[model samples]
Target chain A: MSVNARTMSDDELFYGHKACPGCGGALVVRQALKVLGKDAVAALPAGCMSATGFNFPQLAFANNAMITPFAATASVLSGIEAGLRAQGIKPDGCTVVGFAGDGGTADIGLQALSGAIDRNDDVLYFCYDNEAYMNTGIQRSSETPFGASTTTTPAGPSHPGCVTGKKDLFAMVAAQGIPYAATASIGYPNDLLKKVEKARDIRGTRFIHVMAPCPVGWGFPSSDTIALGKGIVDCGLWYLAEYEDGRFTLNRDPGRFASVADHLRSQSRYRALTDADIVTIEAHRDQVWQRLRQRCSCESS
Target chain B: MLEVIWHARGGQGAFTAARVLGAAASADPDTFALAFPTFGPERRGAPMRAYTKIAARPIGDRSASRRAAIVVYLDDTLFADGWEDELAEGGVVLLNSKVAHPDARVVTVDGSGLAADILGRAIPNTVFLGAIAALCDAVTLENVEEGIRATMPAKLHERNIAVVRAAYDLVAGRARADALPCCSEAAPIEGASGEKEREASSVVSAEPPARIIPQLQELTVAPERFARSTCFQGGHLVSKNAGWRSLRPLVDQQACTGCFNCYLLCPDGTIYKQPGAGSSSTVAIDYDFCKGCGICAKACPAHCIAMVEEGGGRDEALHIRQ
Candidate 1:
């Protein structure tokens, strides 16, 4: 695939807001806001972004920003767009975006998000996946990857990190047969921005799953957030892909994928994995990405 | 018996000040003071009230103060909301102000200025207690200092002691100045541009503020008591979120792979991805929520993203991502 297109355009997000040092979720929200621009109204659930960005006393959005319930992010976003439509405001004039962390998207917000997708609601749903319940002190979420340690899934002699792998969130969303569904990473803003622009333009349940590396939750050096995001793709643990019009496209093909161990080296969360475990994880990664590639190819053909 | 009411935004130490006042009053075997806060959100700048009751004997009545012997305004802006009606007819008002109110009984002190200069931030609660100690003969300065010292950390005792002394001297000086007929009206407050800077700096200056104060709207007349709050917004905050940051993340396209990793990895979702040519598109960062965690710089396998010291120097670690 081609790389490093052009510089991103300026938008409404400004400085002087709060996020932790090296927050990947903040980057995802910022870029999404810019792509959506002044016309966008975002409904965010209780998550890291809500705690940091939509803080008390002030909010970061220049546009309307609503704080919805933990499980109602997608539902509230759908309601906001529906309310606007009921008031005779064209959907095109105002973009409704639902933002939630992995904990919200994969766990608590599943039913609401599923319902929104089922209804084919005209809204852009962005899930900035940090892989755990970061806002509530690094607890394990449904999206927490296997061989990673969280507060709830603490690595110990008997238990080695999370026993279960991450929920296949994109597949779940795409299975809904939405108009647009894609996977993105904060490490590559241009690609993520392109996906967002494409999703919002396509209309009807656009779900973009973004990989936001959390320094605090992921147990990595704050500065290594972007690198870890790329590491997951390079290791075949994660793949960048898009699902549109029932067709699949592999966004980033790692000709020679880095070993899963290489990806794990940077994250302390994965420190519990033994050499044998890494081998098992690598095999799992290959099997998953290989199937994903086959599905993309079959759909494209 | 003495009834004192404190008017403050939350987090400015009004509750703590009232607690300390009560604690100090309790120290005297002859008096007892009951201090508690009203039902208010824990937001930083939302209008909050705390009451302190000191009596020669233990009082049984536990109602809110209808008439106050002394009203302490932790912020001058609260004056705009009107505190004159909360006081007893002969009550005196102690305020954190550079200029005096229209009334002769109104006493002013630059608590924020003193707090910033002394305590290194704006916390006028302790300063107000010191002023009350000076105005009221009931509590000794030693007792007030003891209360402040006991309530605060040992390290803060030195600065808080300095704050109390400074406030004591300030009100004493102002009292002497105002006693003169020529000085009937207090000299006009100076350089009032920073009045917003007076309280605890939580969250102030909302971007594209729709209303100066949030509109308190009722969705239904007969909603549940808990459901009465229709908005998710917290109380007013004077603290700026920006001051929490130390570094910022920036991107370099030359070494970029357009993999969309950083766009997805941002914890705050501040990265914007715009589709251009499918392979190589454009992306932007929203600094408002960036928080400079540099997850992008770390996540970029292409080494295209870098972290720079926020409002500081060029970080040698920031190489050209290309």
Candidate 2:
């Protein structure tokens, strides 16, 4: 059966942690774990998930889980997989996986992740991108998009927040010719679940970059996390795609993009962005999408 | 020395209020104040604490106060077990509750309602600041206003002062710290003083309101019993997180289609899917772990889930069926 809300397992692998209300990252971890199941050995780096999940005397993951150093997520996953296999104790259906945040994957831990993918390690990696270093008080990261205010990238009268574009992580990972790579969002759970299931079935290195909104960092109401996640994809600021066999497939075209301005204005992080700044962001998005449409197969997965 | 312990959720401005109170107390000559907050990895709506200490001499003790002369609860739901034990001899608990608490030592203020009226949102932090100005002789209303101006941004000064003033008047007019009066709605007191002023009034003589016993999901594991510092059972949450919610979602059985959208979308995994009578499956929320993010309600295509005020009532027993 296809992985979806109705067909998902009843057992909860992740629960009762200190993650914020409406935490999109938590949902990604939970849903992905549901797809991966009890045998999946998970490793999380020093991100929101590890900080919230690995409280002393209270472990949140129902399956075997451990925390890695801030920059050792992929390396640790490699080590775990190798150790399990060497000891001849690797479970039949067990899949070694790593869950890291935007900063942990795209910034501090990038080199280690690159090494893991280069070696074609038998592991699945998930980047729950909330677009910033949210756990450490909303610091700017490589994945933080333009015009989004963060502690380091303060928006002021003179300038817009985070002037740089978001790092194209999926493309970077796919550039190495990994077995599989996919882009997902917490707003569309079925798509994310499907990607996870696909990654689980694949043998070589697989990476899934999932956009997870942070209500606190984004300056939106807690209830709007999912809405904002969906809105970002609809507004063309984000896209859903998968890469395999030297081919890139656009899962969602979003033919007529939703209001970019409305989505930007909904989040206070973009409150300082003027109309001109928004125009610049929209222009960039359109240019990127045009290039993507020309290069990638615009067909649903 | 006067010490106050503030009970509030993470984002409720409890630390700000504590700092403002300290600033107010320190404004007085020869007085010193210290304020700090205690929190773990918990986020918004997670229960946490802040403390404020004021003394004539420099405060040497940086530890959390064991007992406080004043204990203020920004969210009344935090008024839980053993609250009375934290009080000093002349201590009082100033709670931001809509319903009147019968205990004379507990002064309930409709702070959330007042804040909603004044600021267009229910931020009850400053309301308690106002209440403290009336209840504590160490700090006056003028001091509080000055503190608000100093501690907060210029744009927020006027509104916070107004809130503080309104709260001060409400508490001062109704009850004093020494001679506490029952403010239950059952007995109506017309005047602030004179004929209405009595040692034991009709409201005081009336039956005390029943203690608010929240129907919380009981826990199977205790934090202490899990001896290992390394790990315990996976998904084993020793404590209930129900305290983190100010609102809760209820599903209307008749309208629910049981698409499992809510169960899938809940960030905390608090929503559960259960097999109903035959083929159809129903959903239920494990209130124990629910942080009340409202994702479930918003995701419901049927529009059956309603997010209601938390203490309005507990979720009805089990399975919101299709």
Candidate 3:
């Protein structure tokens, strides 16, 4: 391993994993392992990462990995932390990370995750948001954005795809008043690593929401995995911001925002969008941006 | 280079067929291949699609296949539901049905029932792979056999091989003599020739009109009302209202174990378990909500689920995998 590689340690923490080519979820775990190092113990749920990380004897990780229920990853991590503390095993340099998808975070696992955050548990909670429940097939979840098509909410003559907007998860997590909560994306690996490293030192609950792109689910080329993340942020559909004890900070300066049409056109899920639909999406985007701007301005002063 | 589209129900071996075909193409030094599924949360018996592209060059436009040189209908019932629309003019259609059809050059085989009979399970994907090899001549039986061995477990390898052989023999006997004469004796050459051929074909064919309608009035009202209905009354309701537009999965109670696995795993939450007096009860899948991802059958430990044909459910349990 090179100097940077050594820092990101290639030791199979999850071990013997099986992920598709250009899987963004797998990349998130890989990058997280690099920052947390070998001492980290990840509690994964029954998602793509979990399936890929625990393939029989061919485990994918070099550190400790435990598979947990879909909606109980946070609870499992809390138990693991308590168990280690009981054994007088101070996780001095070790970190406990709870990994789950958007469905496990914003929907099913939200209660347990909120409880963990409310108690200020000394753990890192990472929700790799691929928009929908990708592992189970492209179905609309709470995190699924408006106007996007999924297997369940298909865009047709009458139906206009997912009419409901994505649940405000970052706001919900921020409301917990955790020590640190930030939004990251696989597109910016260095920034993602920086947040992970920062979260490693924090004693209280540190939440990092990563926007991971799914090629199969999103109807994009597998090669565009990294680009989609960037596109999401660039389109202002997903804003990169952080909260430290209710103090919000905008990470990426909102430059000249691109049209939502440009972003929607790049994805197959949005292929059915009409001009009127595009206009509707643009209006929604502006409203969201305005709200985010107000929040950022309020925090800065 | 051949662009192949697979039409099968969720539990059938459409995805496996695509993978096997792609793998076989990969094994040949002269060919490049790509395979992917149009991801859906479809359950067993729900119509699903998977695609494969074999070329002599690196593949481009890696998206859902719009037109295909070879259309493999794992279930024959899909024919009535516009399977022909996706097929290229003069394309070969390899079917797994017992009844011979005259619309396109059809190579039919009972791969699903055969697999269930021989393997004590319903997995006909391997059988379809054999049929594809004989009908399209894009990949060889040996290549498909190797792909199966590489993908399947050691214990199940022999069974899959047997299934493949049976399918290959059936298709070989039924394949049209002049269907693909150039492919009969040719060794696979890895190059872009196949992709070029497909691109040329796509260009030659009139481009499909943009799905967007400029005028709302021009938008034709869809005859099917299956998606709009809130509840289904009975079996007749499936045929009456949803039959024309929607594809439904028909479960056989004898083969079903009433396992809640399907209920838990359905992404759309379409599978519902009704309150029963005892543990042994039937699980109902709400067709209104089911997207038909087929992860249920993939997750089924008992291997009892089979995708039924769309519109009509008369030809139930036409197994796609052995």
Q: For residue B33, what is the lDDT in candidate 1? A: 69
Q: Which scores better on DockQ, 1 or 3?
A: 1
Per-residue CA lDDT of candidate 3, range B1-322, in tens?
4788888888787987798789887887657678998856758889999999876555655778887877778777776666667777667777777676765556667777888987878667777787777766677788988887777678988988888888778778856766464344332443334445457647834663332101112222232322222221110111111222234555555566766544433332335455444666656665543434354554455666555556555345545423
- Name the lDDT value of residue B241 in candidate 1: 41
Model 3 TM: 0.48
RMSD of each: 18.5, 22.3, 27.3
Backbone clashes counted, model 2? 0
Q: What is the TM-score of chain B in candidate 2?
A: 0.55
Q: What TM-score do all the candidates reach, one by one? A: 0.55, 0.63, 0.48
Write one digit per residue (lDDT tens) for candidate 1, span B192-225: 2123332312354335353222222233222222
Query: Residue B303, candidate 1: how far off, in angstroms?
Result: 10
Lowest lDDT 10-residue stretch of candidate 1 chain B: B182-191
TM-score-superior candidate, 1 or 2: 2
Best by lDDT: 2
* Candidate structures ordered by lDDT, highest first: 2, 1, 3
Model 2 chain B: lowest-lDDT 10 consecutive positions: B182-191
Error of 1 at A41 (Å): 0.7
